[model samples]
Each structure stands twice: as C-alpha cells, then as structure tokens.
Target: MKYQDSLQQASDKAAQVKLFLQRTNLAAHPINYAVSYEYISGYNSELCHIIEHKLLAKAPLDDFVMAELYIRFLAPANPQQEQLLQEASSMVSRMAAYSDVAAEQLDNYIQQLDSSMLQIKNLGADTPLLNIVNQLQHSTTEFRLSQQQMQQQLLLANQQSHQLRHELEQLKQQRLLDPLTGLYNRLAMQNQLDIWFSEQPGRRIAAIAVDLDHFSRFNLEYGNTIGDVILSKVARKVSSYVQNSGLPVRSGGEEFLILLPDVDLRSASEIAEQVRRGVEKLRFVSSRTKKTLPKVTISLGVSLYQQTENWYQFLGRTAEVLLLAKQRGRNQVANETMLAT
Candidate 1:
C-alpha cells in the first residue's frame, strides 16, 4: 500500500525483488521482499545506503540482518521506544565523556604515584615502606585494568548510541513524509521553506499548487480503496517532475504543492504544465475489475515569491491562482500573470 507505482512499474519491481532475493540467497519471505522492494525502488535512502555499504564490504545479508533492517527502517514507529532510545543515547554519551575524563585523571595519578615511589626508593626507604608502596602500586594497577575494561565497554556503548541516534533521525524523517505518496508532508514543506528563507534573505521561490479535478466525485464512484490507488499513482506522477531541485508536498488530501527556489514564474508554470500533461497521459486500470478507469487530470496555479509578502501570503496567492484555473476549467496550468487578465 505504501507503493505508488503503476501496474507495470510494480510488476518490474517485483521482478527485481525476486532477482535480489535469489542473488543474496535470502528466502522470499515477506520481510525480505519488503526490504528489497523498498531498496530497489530507491525511495528509502537510508536503507539503500546501509545495504550498499554491506554489499561493498561483502557482508552476509542473512535473515537476521534483513529483519533488523526492516524493523529499523520500515516498521511502524513506537513513540515510547523512540523516547527511550533518545534517553539512552544521551545517557551513554554523557557516561562516555565522564569515563574519558576519569581515564585521563587516573593516568595522571599513576604517573605521580610512580614518581613518588622512585623518590621513596632513592631516599633509603625501609622494607615495610617499600612493601606498602608496592601494594599501593599493585592496587593502582588493578584499578587501572578495571578502568580500561570499563572504557572498552563504554566505547562499544557509545558506538551503539550513535547508531541508535542515526536510526532515530531516520525515523523522524520518515514521519515527515506522506506514507502513501512518499512526498513531503505539509510540516516538512513548512520546515524546508523556513530553512530556505533563512539561508537566503529575499530569495525568489515559486509555488505550484496542483489539485486533482473532481476527486471527491471520483472517490464516490470508485470507492476509497480504488481512489487511494489512483491518488498514490497520481502523487507519484506529480512528484516525478520536481526531482532534486524542488520540494513536492502532499498539501491536502488530493492537492500537492511544489516549491521551487530561485525559479522564475515562467519556468515554474512550464514545469506545472509538464506535470499536468504527464499526469494526463497516465493510464489506470482497476486490477479487480479488469476495466480501465477514467483518466486523471490536474489543475495547477503557479506564483513567484513577493519580497513584501511572507510565505503564507505567497502560498495563499498561489492557491487563489489555482482556484482561478479550476474556475476557468480543469486540466490546465494557470500562472499569476493571468490573474490580472
């Protein structure tokens, strides 16, 4: 259900998933299939990076390893577990720092003790005194050994803490994305916009508000299940145009907003037009009924950032332009320039 690929695309991924399972000699279990499918889809960057590193190192991709990856990357999040991991990571980091400082102080103490013992030996110390010094030295050595063992344990725990922190960060990112579309959700869009504004003052940004035409009607006719499939596919199609330079966001149930920085109004409108046509060309057929569904179309409104207005105002203006597009008729791109006309 998380997949947004068309029938052919899903079929192709299934083939690739099978090949991956065969090559790795992993059983075609559901967990293994899910991991491989997501990896091959290239949607989960964190999973792909870890798997690629393991492959490079010639590490075994056994069932345990695959299960761990699935749980870490794909499994549903547990808020309590997340909080516990965060607390554990912080505690381990603090303990590691304390141990390091303690180890340094212990080394200095050992050096001072050695110098005192030498001075005592040079100053004609008696056998009883020498024996006491030897005993102290022996105790110190034992303490140092224990400290070293603790340091080793702390070092391993520190490494594990770092891993947990990285996984926690990945989980946070996953939450920012729409589970069905894999596009940035509104929260993520707001965060990215804030970052962009802070990074470059008075920078030009373009927003394209894309709305599916009569989606509620479609949902009513096809039922929610089929509508979801269609929405996922259309969301994927809408995102394909943005690529690396822009943020594609699932702003509403059937609305998407693409944010492009440093882009002019004309270019953004053109991109919107391309998205419109590309989505128009997508063909969807109901797998259960074996009947072709109606073609899906989108209406988009494009606007550029205004130096005098805040981001919300800019987005509002863009949405208004999109509404104008819908008023004129659906399945088209409308830009801010047309607002005056």
Candidate 2:
C-alpha cells in the first residue's frame, strides 16, 4: 500500500520531484527527495496541502523543512520503542515457558508418587503395614492436588504479568502527549529534537513560537475554567496548520512551539502567519451564559536553526523574536529577518 507507482509512473514522479526540488532550492537528499516525491505523486493529501500553501505564498523549502515533512508523513516508527516492546514480550514468553516447565516437573513428581503407592501396596501383608499404605496414598494424593493448584496459579500470574507490561508500555507512550490539547508535550519535543540531531548533526530546524495575544487579560476577565477552554480551542487551530509537517508542542501553560525541520525562515514565518490567522478566526461563547466572548488572537515568532549555536540558544533566539512580535503589537508574526530590520 505504501507504493503503487510502476516503473514508468515511478520515473515520471521522480522527474517531477526533481523539478520541484530545483524550483524550491531544496537539496536532493533522500529525505528531501522522498518528501518531494510524495507531494508530487499526490498520494499524501495533507502533505500536498501544506506544500501547496507554501508554494502559493512563494515560500522557499529548505532541507530542514523537507526533513520535517519526511518525518511527519514518511518516517518509520521509532525502532527503539518497538525494540523495547519486543524485548518485554519476549521476556514474558520466557517466563511463561518456565511456568510450563514447572508444571511438567510437578506432573512427573505425581507420576513417581503413583508408582511408589503401587509398590507399597504390593509389599504390605500385615494390618499395620496396610494402614501405613492407605495413609501414604492419601498424603500423596493431597500433595499432587496442591502441586496442580500451585501450577495453575503460576500460569495465571504469568498471564497477568504480560498484561501489566503491555499496559505500562501504553502508559509510557501517553506520557509524551499533552492531555489537554492532544499535542506532544515538552518532553516529547525534546526527545524528537535529540533524535534528529543525533542522526544528522547538520539537520536544519525552524521553530515557531506561539503565544495567545492578551491571554492573561482574557483569563482575568473570564474565569480560569473559561480560559482553559479557549486555550484548548486555540491549540487545536494552531496544530491544524502543522498536521503532518511539523511537531506541534504544548511547551507549557498558554505557550506552544511548532518545529519544522528542513524549512527556511521565510516559510516558517508564513506558516506562523497561517497559525495566527487561524487562531484569530476561532470564536468562543460561554456555554452556560449563552454569551459570546471576545475574539481570540495569537502572536508568533519564527527562527531557523543555526549551526553556530546550540539548541537552547536557537530557542532563545526564537523567544526573542516572539518578544519582538509582542512588543510591536500583538496578533502579528515576527521572525529573525524582522529583528535585523
């Protein structure tokens, strides 16, 4: 299902992807080429939409942005996580096998008792000897029953352990996501970035720092409960723009960061503008009072990663850009270029 293009069709798609890369000034790296190929093939509608928007606005795509698109739409699932699950499952299987071996050993012991009982009955002739054989048989039978019961309990314990391990794996996965907005949390964002850098040291990354305009005032005007609703709504709107091209993160309270890999500063700013506009369009009303609330807007700042600086420094620069947007006027998108201006 992943690939349906035949020889001729695949060649044609490859040609178009080459053209797209040339037009957009993107390098023909494997990740970049694959993303372009997907966009040109039109198999991925969401990928096409995001790239089309950038094209319409004449925003250039770079290696960083292309890398991000590849990751969002085409990258394989995390091997480390998969390996962990596989290892855990394997361990449970081994434990279950051990339980089976224990059960088999108990069965062998029961058989031995049966053989001994028959031998004792044959040897007995006196009344006292016969009584001893009866007592021995009863004790052997009770011991056999107890061993079977213990074996059953052991099997049950192994099954429960397997189930518990699976649940723990699920919980570990959920921890990376924000419960409020259904977006990745800060920890997930960091882990993703770390992976990106570890795999490719020169990987380009662009960050869009987003903050709701006059959010504190809005929260003060309405209750925190109402503010939370608005925040969640805004998060949805912002994340929509980044569906498959970037990591939409709920960094902290009332703050979000959209990270696009293989994207240029201009393209990132454009995406940030789209997010700002989208949030501006969301209208909120109090469900209890049936009264409409004031329109919500967001301000954003965009920054491209620098090879000369560390990630923290890059984010700090992004935060600075966001501060500039806030200072100039809320509800606008600012970028590193504007900082120079």
Question: Best by lDDT, which number?
Answer: 1
Candidate 1 Cα errors over 4 Å, as ranges: 1-152
Q: Tens digit of lDDT per residue, candidate 2, span 228-319?
A: 99988888888889857589998656788999988988888888988888888788889999999999888899999999866656776777
Model 1 per-residue lDDT at 293: 94
Q: How close is candidate 2 to the true structure, as a TM-score?
A: 0.56
- Candidate 1 lDDT (Cα, 0 to 1): 0.84
Clashes by residue pair, model 1 = none
Candidate 2 regions with alpha-carbon error over 4 angstroms: 1-163
lDDT per residue (tens digit) for residues 63-152 in model 1: 756865776678876446767767866776776577567667877887888888779888988999989988988987897788778768
For each candidate in turn, the TM-score is 0.60, 0.56
